[model samples]
Each structure stands twice: as structure tokens, then as C-alpha cells.
Target: MRVLITGVAGFIGMHLALQLLQRGDEVVGIDNFNDYYDVRLKESRLQRVVDADTAGKFTFIRLDLADRAGMAKLFAEEGLDAVVNLAAQAGVRYSIENPLAYIDSNLVGFGHILEGCRHNGVKHLVYASSSSVYGANESMPFSVHDNVDHPLSLYAASKKANELMAHTYSHLYNLPTTGLRFFTVYGPWSRPDMAMFKFTQAILAGQPIDVFNYGKHRRDFTYIDDIVEGVIRTLDHTARPNPEWSGMKPDPGTSKAPWRVYNIGNQNPVELMDYIRAIEEALGKKAELNLLPLQPGDVPDTYADVDALVQDVDYRPSMSVDEGTRRFVQWYREYYKV
Candidate 1:
């Protein structure tokens, strides 16, 4: 399959692109390489993806999702078979300061992606959603079937908006769209802003790590490899109208149109202190902790109910924080020569 993967230079995108390329799929990757984190890290990831595939099955394009003309032209010319839209303005805290960034990238950019997929006759459109969308709902485990009308942050709101937009396209154009509501994704080459990356960097540097919610938070931290596998499986499993869906009692997870949403997570939610302990064990270094209140726009816990995903795709994330942290520590040491 020939696929177009947006944000291909990003942490998850880079890993997903490599897997797709290794599986013999012709891949066209695009990213604006914004300085949301480190552009150098993004460049290195892109280079690694290129270096890994000597077969010339991968192509990288420097394009932003917000570039309407460029996106239109690329979709028109590329003859893309499938699309994996991972490009977005991420970070819940960052969204509070830069609300417009979320509007431009997550909302406007997603609109463009929907248009591209609709017009290009793409077989399937798999896009990134977020677990944060389950805002204000204190359910033990977040389920796709539950209502997600209240999003605490602009980032979460934008993600929820994406789901609605995708449904419109699916209803009007018969475009098959699947939205993967990703949990706390972490692993090697992880974004520097994420907790795993920040904790690792601080621990090695002997700096105090900020323990949010006084280390009371819990997260379903899915490893990158597991996420990539779920993505591939979901992308292959094109969205179809749920015959069981009823307008009388509409299921938020599915639609009468060819649209669906599934949570891609580790199912097992680990406490923040436990995750930090795992990192400490991995690096063989103790972290000086600064226990802090939960920042605005942050949730106390995120537990994903991925039964729908497992039923449809026969896949589940199983990597434990201990093992994942160990792998990340190894990569960080080698990459930074620490």
C-alpha cells in the first residue's frame, strides 16, 4: 500500500513510518518541522527513517498541515492510497498559552486532511485523536462509547472537533475514517515535552523532576511500538457503518456512516510515582522530586477501555512501564552519549 503519513518526522510518526516502510509499503511523509520541541531531534528522526530504508520506499516532504494550497496540491498529485493524519499542535499545557495554535493545526489543519482524503479516493483515513477528550467524565476507564462533550483544554476540544468533522465527511462523501484516541504514548525518541522524556532528562542531569498532582496521577502509557502496530492494524481495518448503531441511542464510538473511534492504550493505568520509580530503576539514578499540584488543563488519571479496538483489530498494547522505561533509558544514553 502507498500511504501518506502526516507528521512523519514526529516521535510516533517517525516510528510508524519506519514500520510501514519495513513492511514494504511505499510511504510519503510530510512535516513542517515546527519548533514545538527540538527541530534537530525532528531532523535526526527523519534522517533515521531515511537511513533505515535503503529500498527507497519512503519520501519525506517538508509541508505543514496548515498550508492549504500545498496540502491540496500534494493530495491531488500524490495519488495516495491511504492517509494517517498524525500532525497536530500537541501538549495540553501548551494549549492553554497558545490556544490559536490548536485552532490552526488541530482544527483547520484537520479540515484540510478531511478534504484531501475525501477528494483523493483514499481507501482509508486513520487519524490521531486523544484520551484527553474524555474530560470531566470521571469514569473509572474511559470508553469510546461514553459521551465526551466536556473537554478541559483547547487541545482536547480540538481533538473532539476532529471526530465530529470526520463524521461529517464520512456521512457526506462515504469516506471511511477511523479516529484512534491515543493514550499517553511514550518510548524511544519520545518528544522532549512529554513526562517520560522530561523525567529521564532531569534524572540524568541531577535536576528535580516536577511530580504533577503530587504524584497521584495515573496514565495508560502506551509504548510506541504497540501504538504503531495498533495504527497499522486500524488503518488496514477500514471504517464501516456499524449496523448496530441506533440514532435513538447513538454510540459515540461509531456512526451509521463509515466513521469510528477507538482508544489505543495500554489498558493498564500506572500511577505517576510508580512510573517515576521505573525510570529511576532504568537509569540507575534517583530523581529529586518536586511534588506539585496538577496544572490547569491536566487530568488526574487516564485509563483507556480498548475492548472495541481489540474486538475490531485483534490487538492490544502490553508493554509495561518498567520495560518501556528501560528501553527509553538505553536509547537516551546512546543518543545523547550520557
Candidate 2:
């Protein structure tokens, strides 16, 4: 199968591209490599994909999702069999400073992708939605079937909008679209902005790490491999119309249209302090603690109910938070030479 993966240089996208290539699928990866974090890290990830022995199965293009003309051209030329739209302006706090970036990328850029897929005979459209969409909900385990109308941050709002937009496309064009509400994805080649990376960097520098919400937050930090696995499975199995779906009592996770949403989480929420302890254990050093209140657009906790994922794809993200953190710390040390 020929697959087009947007944001191919991104943490998850890079891993997905390699997975596809290794399976003998031709992968075309597009990324602007914006300065959301360090472009160097994204470049290096792209290199790893390109440098692989199966690299001949992969192609890289430097392009932004906001470029409508270029995006259209890509779809027209490539005639993609399927697409994974992972490109977005991805940070909760940063969205406060640069809300326009989210609008342009998450909104407008995604609009272009939907248009392209709808017109290009693409079989499947799998997109990245964040667990942040479960904002303000006090539910113990976040479920896709639960209500998600209240988004505390612009970032979360944009993701919710993406899900809505995708449903519209699916309904209008019979497009098979799947939106994955990813948990806190972390592992090797992770975004520098995420907690795992920041904590590791601070611990290695012997600097104090800021414990958000006074170290009271809990997150279902899903490993990159698990995320990639869920994505691949969903990509292969195109969304189907829900036979039980009714407009009278609609399910947020499925519809009459070929659209579906699922929580791709580890189903294990770990406390912020415990996560930091893992970092400390892996690095053999304790972090100078700087406890702070929760920042805007932040949530108290996130726990994903991946029961649907398990029942559908036999998806079980079994990596313990301790093991995942240790691996991340090890990678951070090796990558940064700390």
C-alpha cells in the first residue's frame, strides 16, 4: 500500500513512517519541520527513517499543511491510497501564546487534508486527536463515548474541532475517517516540549524541574510504540458505519457516517510525582523540586479507557510508566550526550 503520512518528521509520525516502510509499504512523508521545538530533533528523526535499510520505500518532502496549493499538488500527484494526518501546532501552553498557529494548522491545514483525501480516492484518513479534548471532565477513565464539549484550552478546542470536521467529511463523502485521541505519548525521539523530555533535560543539567499542579497531576502516558501500533491497526481497518448508531441518541465515538474515534492510551494513569521519581531513578539523581500551580489549558489528570481499542485491534499498550520513563531517560542521555 502507498501511504501519505503528514508531519512525518514528528515524534509519532517518524515512528509510523518507519513502521510502514519496514512492512514493504511505500511511504511519502511531508513536514515543514517548524520551530515548535527544535527543528534539529525533527530533522534527525527524518534522517533515521531515510537512513533505514528499507529507506528506498520512503520519500520525504518538506512542506507545511497550511500550504493549500502545495498540499493539493501532493494529493493530485501522489494519488495516495491512504493518509495519516499527524501535523498540527502541538502544545497546550504554547497555544496560549500563539493561538493563530493552531487555527492555521489544526483548522486550515486540516481542512486542506480533508479536501485532498476526499477528492483523491483515498481509502482511509486517520488523524491525531489529543486526550486533552477530555478537558474539565472529572471522569476516572476518559472514554470516547463521553461528552467532550468543554475544552479549557485553545489547543483542546482545535482538536475537538478536528474531530467534528472529520465527521463532516465522512458524512458528506462517505470517507472512512478515524480520529485517535492520543494520551501523553512519550519515548525515544519525543518532542522536546513534553514532560518526559523536559524532566530528563533538567535532571541531567542538575537543574530544578517544575512540578506542575504542585505535583498532583496524573497522566496516562502512552509509549510511542503503543501509539504507533494503534495507528497502524486503525489505518489497516478503515472505519465502518455503526449499525446501532441513532440520531436520537448519537454516540460521539461513531456515527452513520464512516467515522470513528478511539482513545489510544496506556489505560494506566501515573502521578506526576511518581513520574518524576522514575526519572530520578533512571538518572540516578533527584530533581530539585519547584512545585507550581497548574498552568492555563492544563488538566488535573488524564486516564484513557482503551477498551474499545483492545476489543477492536487487540491493542494493549502494556509498557509500564516506570519502564517507559527509564527508556526515555536512557535515550535522552545518549541523544544529548549528557
* Residue-by-residue lDDT tens digits, candidate 2, 96-177: 9999999999999999999999999999999999999999999779998998999999999999999999999999999999
Please state the error at residue 325 of candidate 1 in Å.
Answer: 0.5
Per-model TM-score on C-alpha atoms: 0.99, 0.99
Q: Which regions in candidate 1 have their CA more than 4 angstroms from the true location?
A: none
- The sequence of per-residue lDDT tens digits that candidate 1 reaches over residues 1-96 is 999999999999999999999889999999999999989999999999999988989888899899999999999999899999999999999999
Off by over 4 Å in 2: 53-55
Candidate 1, residue 136: lDDT: 88
How does each model score on lDDT? 0.94, 0.92
